[model samples]
Target: GAGVSQSPSNKVTEKGKDVELRCDPISGHTALYWYRQSLGQGLEFLIYFQGNSAPDKSGLPSDRFSAERTGGSVSTLTIQRTQQEDSAVYLCASSRFLSQETQYFGPGTRLLVL
Candidate 1:
């Protein structure tokens, strides 16, 4: 089966413009995660969805950031107003089980706001 993948491997946009990044996880995966990583920085968890559990959005930086998973497979992260500070690699991961499961990561969607 296919592993996780993200679209627009790289993105460049002006401040205030909106952008949407997509992620496709492996089939049969029940847990999905979204994270952001600044250049040379570690990953920062954004949101996570597992089966019927309530999606965790605690790590979302601001109101401008949001995400949703459809049919527990593909997910999308949307930024309402692009900012220079938002420039980073957005990574997506998926796992079979929620606990102690190592999530597989995508190449990530790199965003650059100028």
Candidate 2:
């Protein structure tokens, strides 16, 4: 793809349900990140991955939210036992090397937990 792309542009799930959001980053990008933005709020970082390893996950709001990157490309964010607070736009971004570089963002997955 030309840039980062995410699957299921919109997802509606019930409370306590599990959801998996997928992101395919730009080719050759080494760093990937997961984020979420709630209504009327700033973007909140969730996780960061260098290659296939996640070194920074301090931003995760709860243990129910977990992410993984495989083959340094596609990444998945799994939200288990979703709650209304978890309803937000799940965003994915990728950079050339590290977090300091410019990041290309995907369209984002809109997750609505009711």
Question: Evaluated with lDDT, which candidate comes out highest?
Answer: 2
The clash count for each model shown is 0, 0
In the range 2-113, model 2's lDDT, one tens digit per residue, is 9999988999999999999999999999999998999888899889999999987889999998999999999999999999999999999999999479999999999999
What does candidate 1's lDDT look like per residue over 30-70, in tens digits? 98888999999999989888863435677899999988888
Off by over 4 Å in 1: 52-54
* Root-mean-square deviation per candidate: 1.3, 0.8
35, model 1: CA deviation in Å? Answer: 0.8
Name the TM-score of candidate 1. 0.94
Candidate 1: give the clashing pairs. none
**lDDT of each model, Cα atoms only?**
0.89, 0.94
